[model samples]
Target: MTSSQIQVPAQEEGGATILEIGQQPDAWREVGGETDEGLARFLRGITERPGLRVILTGAGSSAFIGQIAAPALRRHLGCRVEPIATTDIVAAPRDHLEPDTPTLMVSFGRSGNSPESLATTALADELVTDIWHLVYTCDRTGELGRAHRDRANSRVVYLPERTNDTGFAMTSSLTSMLLSCLLTLGPAGRGNVEALAQAAEHVATLQPDIRALAQSGPQRIVYLGSGALAGLAQESALKLLELTAGVVVTYFDSPLGFRHGPKSVLDGCTLVVVYVSNDPYTRRYDLDIVAELRAQLSPDAVRVLSCEPIPQELGTATVLPGLAHLDDAQAALPYLVFAQYLALFTALEHGKTPDNPFPSGEVSRVVQGVTIHPISPSDLEAR
Candidate 1:
């Protein structure tokens, strides 16, 4: 069954978002091809430093990039890597910062103008005595890039200008920064950037099937994954919530974690989407949940996405070929594109404007109504 679908064109309200979502493949190609010697030196220095810790920070959707990249970055860099949101750093700097540790704070921003974005970086400078800054932003003119560009001990990498999404949600901007960060901070290999982009392009073609899923009128949506894909699930859930303007309730959990009481949210009106892992060990747990959900729910109510095909009796799957060799983190790029497309068509299904879901401005493109309080040296002393 199909509803009156709103096509994506320049004239529609969702045109920017639709175009941005489609532009990701090209944008990724550009980011993946870019090389920066200074940025390399900055990262190389961090890797060589003894007792160094890397902290990835951002706000809202921007923050999820860190969550998606942290595990792989840690394994490749051989150091402590943590994904701490800029919101958390702003609200509770003391708990997350280490004054004496040699730290490299990687900041990911779409606009790079969010109050928390600047505030968190400022707090890191004040709190971490021996610290360096690595920034990835789509906006070259944004305060986050401008403020740190010329500063000593700081290196800023600006992604392709088009990645500065004009739409309300972070689409190309999020994925570009995540890709650039991984290519720069991860191991020496540049990876198969062309293949990754091609996989994302393939996901874009699945729009028709995805739109049908959206049109099914499920009141609840759940996204589940394991490892880095778990973080991808969080971002996937956010896309649905943002595009639908909170009309559709969404939940995200790790495949194994869902068994611990979180699975009770399932109902007849719910649709469950699972991202099966490429790792042999992790795939076992991911498939276990998918099998369990298929047994309990109608086959139509569950969907599985994997890099390779699963058993037919387990149910239908959207298999992204050529990506089976990718680590879970790299695989997240195409998985995210699928989630974005589903969110877009779902927004149109509900007759909501994808570009600006909240017409009344209850929520905004860049967050509003945040007050960044100054953290004085005395405040630190008291704590």
Candidate 2:
């Protein structure tokens, strides 16, 4: 059924989650409109610097945004681009930070209050002699946003207020920040944003089939992709795990990477979803795995999410027609909608609350129980 026909109850446990997921299309448009000249000028100045390296960071789903965007940004800016998680940076600052490298830290946070996110910014200042920040967050009042608003070396770009998702899982917030980064720092433009929004609206039409599969009772779900799409696969896996509160097992990997050893997770009770890349060269590897899996598994066991059509023997496909021109990084926005829907329906089918899956506080919307240890200049010198 279409999104309008899904009929979520007013007081439903996952009502907010469903609403937030549906709101992404419009929120993305706002991202396009909000890409001001000042942000673009700031980024241009940083990219022109000698010996520059860009690091994209966040924690959890927020971190996945950097993974998906780094490849495209690296190509656009012609500089070193790395996607490092705030969790990793906080735990091992010396490994990822350089004392003299000119670096731009693009921090993505839904709530802007994640402890690791906050700590990583401070650590960058302490560790890097030449550092700049481009902070993208949903909450204006959040610590990350507040901390960087007036800083000399940082610029805070707040997305539309509604993009600050109230649900336990990030739906609108993730895509909004991702699109903002692409439009401002990467090669995406207003036209790309419009196309992505249209494609995401079309994803709602596939929900009926996605919901059918969710109800079919698969014990395990696997997502596979390549390049930037591999990061999309990772985020897709997290959405399912978080919404189900660990009731369902999930895994993610690149299509070729899966064959090395990870493909052993496949079984009659498992479902595999592949995010097909838009690039012709990368699409070859994606199709190879889909072909191999269909040969060994049930014809209905594998699903393909792509921008173009495949051979008839490939089984069911969710083909979004207008996205063929965009590269895999830009195409990632609509491709993610399908994954989001699958996770939402799977949680509903399993009788879990999509909004508050971990009601007992096993996990929280903003992470909990993290202690940001103090690190000094002496700590770096001793090392």
The candidate that achieves the highest lDDT relative to the unseen native structure? 2
Reference-based lDDT, residue 198, model 1: 93
lDDT score, candidate 2:
0.90
Q: Over all chains combined, what TM-score does candidate 1 have?
A: 0.96
Q: How much lDDT does candidate 1 score? A: 0.89
Runs off by more than 4 Å, candidate 2: 1-13, 381-383
1-383: candidate 1 lDDT, tens digit per residue: 11124345652435779888998998888888889887787678778898889999998888899999998999998889999999999998998999999999999998789999999888888888999999999988899999999988899999998888877888999999988888998742466788889999999898889989999999999999998898899999999999999999999999889989999999999999999998999999988888899889888888899999988778789999898888888889888999998998889989888888899999999889998898877778754
> In model 1, what lDDT does residue 55 have?
96
Flag clash pairs in model 1. none
TM-score of each: 0.96, 0.96
Worst 10 residues of 1 by lDDT: 1-10
